[model samples]
Target: MSSPEQTTAIVDAATDPARSPRSLREAWLALAGLSAVFLFEMLDNSILNVALPTIGRELHASTTALQWVTGAYAVVFGGLMLAFGAVADRFGRRRTMLIGLALLGVASLATAFVSTAEQLIAVRAATGVAAAMTTPGSMALAFRLFGADGLRVRAITLISTVGLVGLAIGPTAGGLVLAVAPWQVLLLVNVPVAVLAMIGIRFGIAADAADELHRDPVDVAGAVLGTAAIVLALVAPTLFVDAGTGSWVPWAVTAAAVPAAVLFVLRERSARHPLLDLRLVARPLVSSGLAFKAATGLATAGLGYLVTLQLQLDWGWSPALAAVGMLPQVVVLIAGGSLVSPFVERVGLERAAAISAAAVVGGLAVYSLLGRFGYVWVALALVLVAAGMRVVGVAAGTNVLRGLPKERTTIGAALVDTASEVTSGIGIAVTGTVLAALFTGDLAASHWTARQTAEFQQAATVAGLTLTVVAALLVGWGIIRGRSAPITADDSDSSAGRDDSPGAEADAPRAAQHAG
Candidate 1:
C-alpha cells in the first residue's frame, strides 16, 4: 500500500465507530491480526537458527560467520527495540506496524536471494529492524483494542501463547521445510505470510495514532550509545569462546561496553523523551521482573541452539527427526502456560519467579548428566524446565504491563521484549561458545571420537552449572526483596529526577490491579 493510502485507510478505521471492536467478533479478528505479527517476528529468531548449518555449507561460510548469521538479528533487534517502541508511541502504532510489514517483506525477500554469508547476515539484521518496528505496535494495538483489564490480560496471554507456539515450532518448521526444499525457499515463505498479515491488519485492526503529532524528542544519542553497548557485550563472549582467537578483542570490547552503558544511562536520564526510563530499572519488581523474563528466553529460544547443535552436530540426527524429538518440550510449554495465572495469583509474582528459576536449575541439572542418562531423560527434564520458564514469563509480563501506564503500552512492550532478546543472545553466546570449544577440543587429534565425546559432555555440564548459579541468584533476590508496587511509566519530566521527594518516582505512572 502507498503511504497516503495506508494513512487514509487507518485514519478512516480509527474514526469509524462501526469499525471499533465493540462486538466480540471484531475483537477476536483484531487479536488475530496483532497475534499473527507477533508470531512471525519471534518465529524468525529460531527458524533461521535451524538454517545456519545449511547456509554455511551452501555459502562456504566459517563457524564465526554462522554465529553472526544467528546472532546478528537479535543483536540489532535488542539494540533498537526500545527506540522503536518510543517511536510507535510518538507516531501512530498502526502506521508503524504497516511499515514494519513492508520492511519485513522486503528483508525476507532479500534473505532469500543472498549469495554470500555477509549478505545473509545483513539481511537478517534488516529483519530485526522490522521486528523492532512491529512488535511494540502489535502489543500497543492490542492494549488499545481492549481497555478492560480482564479482557486485555486475556488478549495479551493469547498473543504470548502464540509467540510461545512459534518459538516451539520454529526449528521443527524449518527442518520440515529444508526436508522438501532449499533454505532460500524457507525464507521466501515469509513474503506471503507478511502479505497476509498486512491484509489482516488493514481490515481488522483499528487505527490509533498519537493524539499529538509530537510529544518528546526521539533520543537518537541514547539509541546509538545503547546499541554500541549491547553489540560490544554480545561480541565479547563470542570472540572469547573462539579457540584460537586472542583475548584482546574480547577484553577490549568488554571494557568499551562499560562506558557506553554508563553514557546510555546518563543520556536516558537527561533526554527530553528518553527511549526508556533508567529509574524503571531501579524498581525491585521491575528489575526482577525483567530478569525473570530473560530467563524464559534463556530456557526457550536460547536453549534451542544448544539442542540443535547436539541433535544435528553431535548425534547426527537429520533435522526432521531432531525437530520431532523437540515436540515434547512444545507440549510442555502449552500445558504450562495455562498454569501461570493461577500460580502467580496464589504465590505472588516474586515467589513464583523463584520457583520458576528453580525448575530451570533442576532441568539444567538433569541436562548436565546427559551422558549418564539418555536424551529421553534430558528431554523429560527440559519439559519441567520449559514449564517453569513459561510461568516466569507469563507472571513477569502481566506485572510489567500493570506497572507501566496504559498510555506507554508500546514502550512497556519494547522494554519487556528487549530484556528477553538481549538475554537470549547472551544465553546463545555463552552456551554455543562452550559447545564450540568442546567441539574443537584438541588440535592434535588423539582419539578424535573420544575427545569430541568428552568435550561435548563437559560443555553441557559447564553450561548447565553456569545457568544454575544464575538462576540460584535470582531465587535469592526474589525471596529477600520487599514487595514492590507495580510502577507506572514515567513521562518526559526532569522534575521527578530533580526533586528527591519521597515516593516521587512511584507517583509517576498510575498503578493498576497487581497480578501479584
Candidate 2:
C-alpha cells in the first residue's frame, strides 16, 4: 500500500547516497527497526501476567482494580485499533508511528513513577492507546517500504517471529525482572528501547508529506461508532457477568450490538469517507484473510492456554520452568518465520493454509500422546505448532493485501489485525472456561478430595485430542474455501500498481470516499 509519496521516498532512498544503504542491507535495517517496535510493544501484552500478584501486593489493589490495570490496556487497545488504522491512512504511517513511539516512551516513563493502582491503570491505558496506533501503522509501513510481494512476505515472516518471541518472552523476561527489580521497572525498561527504536525509524524511513491534505476528510463519525461497537462488544460480555446477574446481560449486549453495527454500516455506506470500505470487505482476499487470522488466534491461543495449564497446574512446573520447556516451540517458530515466504509464494495461499493446518493437527497428535512418552512429546508437538503458525500468519497477511490499492492497504490490514485481537480475547475466555471445567472435573474424579497428577494428565490428554479435532475441521474449511475462492490478477503480479481492471477503476471513487 505504498502511496506515491512513499514510493518516491523509497525510490529516492535507494538512489540517494544521503540516506540508507543502496543494497539489501537497507531493507534488513528497515525491517529490524520496525520489528524492534513491534517486539517491545507486543512483549508487554503477556509480561504483566506474572507481575500482577506483585503489583497487587505493593499497590494494595483490589481484584477488580488489578484486572483494570491489565484489562484497561486490552480494552483501549482493541477499541481504538481500527480508528488508528484509519488515522494512519489519513495522516502518514511513519508520522502515526512516531507519535505512537513518543507516547509509549512517555507512558512507560510515567508508569515507573505511579504510586497507586489507579495511576498504574491510567498509564497502562495510555500505553495501550499508543500500541493501537502503532500496530497496524507499523505493518502498513512495512508494506510501503517493500512493495514487492516477495519482499513483503519476507518482512511479514520476520515480524511474525518477533511477535511470537515477544509473547513467549513475556513471562520468562518478567520473571527475570521480578528477580532483581520492582514491577515498575518492567514498565521502565521500554523507555530506552523506545528511544533506540525511534532513532532506527528516523534513519530507516524517508520523510513523507502528510496525506490528509490530499485524502478525504477523516471519518470522525465512523471512528466513534466503530470504536464504541468494538469496545462494547468486547467489554460487555465479561463486565456484565456475575453469579447473581441474570442472562439479560448477553441479550442486552446483543440488542445493543445491532444498533451499533447497523449505524456503523449505514455510516460507511453513506459517508463521504467511510472508515471501512464496504466494497473491499466483499473481496475474497480481504474477507477470507480476516476469517483465517481469527481462526489462527483462536487455535493458537487456545493451545497455548491449555498447555500452560498442563505444564504448571498439572505437571507442577514453575512459570520459568515451563517457559524453558517451550524452547523447542520458540526455536521452531523462529525458523518457520524465516522460511514461510518461499513456500507461500511457490504454492497458492489456500494450499499453504492447508499445509499449516496439517502441521497443527500433527503437532496436537503428538501432544495428545504425551502421557505415554513424557515431555519429549511436548517438544515434538511444539515444533509442528511453530511451523503451522508461521505459514498461517504469513499466508493470511499476503492474501489480505494482495491486489489491494496501495493507498487503502492499511484499512485491510487493520481489519485483519482487529480480528486477531478480538479473537485473542475470545480464545482466552474459551480456553479458560474449558480448562477450568477440566480442572473441576479432575477434582471430582478424586471425589472432591486431594487431586492426583494422573487425573490432570488424563484431562490434558482430552484437551489435546479435542483441540486436534477442532483444528482439523477448521483447516479443512479453509482448504475448502481456498479451493473455491478465485485469485485476482493483482495477486499474481510482482508489483501492486496493476490497475488494468474495470473493478480497480471503480475502486478509485471508493478510495476517495474516505480514509481507510
Candidate 3:
C-alpha cells in the first residue's frame, strides 16, 4: 500500500485537472477567501467581549441578557453546522457561501438597528446561523480548491493562522472601534468585510458541486433532537443554581439531554444520510482532532476574555492599554503557526500534534499559576499559550480534513468548527457561573466585608487552577489519542486500481462511490 503522500501524488497524476493557473494563484485565491471569512466570523466572536459593558449600559441589558447575546450565537451556530454543511454540498460551495455572507451582512445591519435586548439576541442568533454556514463552507471549499493532501495541509495551516491572528488582535481591534465609533459599529463592520469576501469568492475561486450530494431525505428529526440537546446543555448553568444551591433542576435537565442525544445518535446511524454524519466522527483521526479543537478552543477563547477582564477590572488598565499588552501574544500566535507547518509534514501528523499539545498543556499550566501577578506576567503566559495553540490548531484542523473522504470534507470541517464553538460557549458560561457564585456566596456571608473580598479572591484562584488542570488533561488526551488512519480517498482509489481482476469493472464504480 502507498503512503498518504505517495497516494496523494498518484491520485493527482490520474485525473489532473487542467492547470488553469499557477499553484500560487490558486493558493492566494483560497487565502483571500479564507482570511476574509475568518476575519468576519472571529471579529464577531470577540468584538462583543470588548464592547459588552458599553452595550449593556446603552441597551439596558442585564448580565443574564448579555450572556444570551453571546450564547445565542454559539448555540445556533454550533447546532446548525451539519445542516448548512450538507446544504453546501447539495448545492454548491460558492452559491452557499455567497448566500450565507449576504444573510450575515443583513443580520449585522439589523443588529445595528435593534432597540430591545430581545431584538439584539434574535439578530445575533441569525448571525450565528450565517456564521455556521460560512466557517465550514469556507474551509471545505479551500480543501476542494487546493487538493486534499500536501496542498490542503499548508492552506489549512495558513487559514487557521490568519483566523487566530484575528482573534488574538481582536481586543485591540474592538477597542479601537469602540473608542472612535459606537457599539453598533462592531456589528456594522462585518457588512463591508462580508461583501468583499462574497465578491472575491464569486470571481476568484472556482466552484465544484458535490458529485454525490446526499439524496437521502433531509434529517429534520435528527436536527431537531441535536439542536435541543445543545440548547439544553448550553443553558443548564443558567437554568439551575450553583453547586451550593443543590438544585435538582440542573441534574434533571442534564439527564434528559443525554437521552435526547442518544436518540439523535441512534436516528443518525439508522438514517440513510443524517444531517450530521456520526459515521465520519467514528474515525479516530476525525474524533481526536475535533476533541483537540474543542478543549483547546474552549480554554483559549474563554481565557482571553478572562484576562481582559482581569486587566481592566483588577489592575485598572484602560481597554486600549490591555489591548496593547496583548499585542505581543498575537504576534507570537502568527509566528507559532508559520513555524509549525514545515514540521507537520516532516514528523507526521500525530507526533507533531502531540508535541504541540504538550507545549499547550505546559503553557496553560503556567497561566493557571502566574496569572495573578499583574498584566506583565499574564501577558508572558498568554504569549506562550497562544504559541502552543498556533501549532496544535493547524495540526488538528488539517489532519482531520486530510483523513476524510473527499465528500465528507465540508461536513467534517463544519463538525470541527461546531465542536470548537460549542465548547467555547460552554466554557464561558461555566466560568461566568463560577465567578458569580464565588462573588455572591462571599458577599452574602459577610455583608460585603473585607473578609468576603479575600474569600472571593481565594475562590477565583482555586477555580482558575481547576480549569487549567481540566484543559491540560483534555489537550493531553487529544495528543495521546491522535492517530490518523490510512483511509483517505487517494489511498482507497489507489488500492482499487491495484485490484484489477475479473470483477474489477463491476466493483470500480462501487469503490469510487464509497471513496467519495
Top candidate (TM-score): 2
Instruction: Estimate, for each residue in 140-251, the C-alpha lDDT of model 3 and write its tens digit.
Output: 7666664424455566667777677777677768888888889888888889988878866765566653452445566788878877787676656455433333667776
Task: Give Cα distance to truth, residue 365, candidate 2, Å.
Answer: 6.8
Better candidate by TM-score, 1 or 3: 3
Off by over 4 Å in 2: 1-11, 14-23, 208-214, 236-259, 270-272, 348-350, 361-380, 434-495, 498-516
lDDT of 1 by residue, 258-306 (tens): 8998999888898877777776555565566676666656655445665
- lDDT per residue, candidate 2, 1-516, as tens digits? 446655555456734424432223445546666887778766885888889999999999998898889888888988898888877777777777889989999999998679899999999999989888887766776766653445555667777678778877788789898999988888887788678667756666765434311287888999999988887766654553221124566447647866997899999999987888787676655566665676666666666766776677666678679888878878787666756765765564556766875776777667777633677877777787778877877777666666366666666677877887776655555544444455544432313324555555665666566656665666666656555655566544522443435454234323422211
What are the lDDT figures for the candidates, one per model?
0.67, 0.69, 0.68
Task: Compute the lDDT for candidate 3.
Answer: 0.68
TM-score of each: 0.78, 0.80, 0.79
State residue 391's C-alpha deviation in candidate 1, in Å: 2.7
The list of candidate 3 runs beyond 4 A from truth reads 1-22, 57-63, 168-182, 210-212, 237-255, 305-325, 369-377, 429-465, 484-516
Per-candidate clashes come to 1, 3, 0
TM-score of 3: 0.79
Off by over 4 Å in 1: 1-26, 49-66, 111-113, 175-182, 209-214, 243-247, 298-325, 335-354, 369-371, 374-377, 432-459, 478-482, 485-516
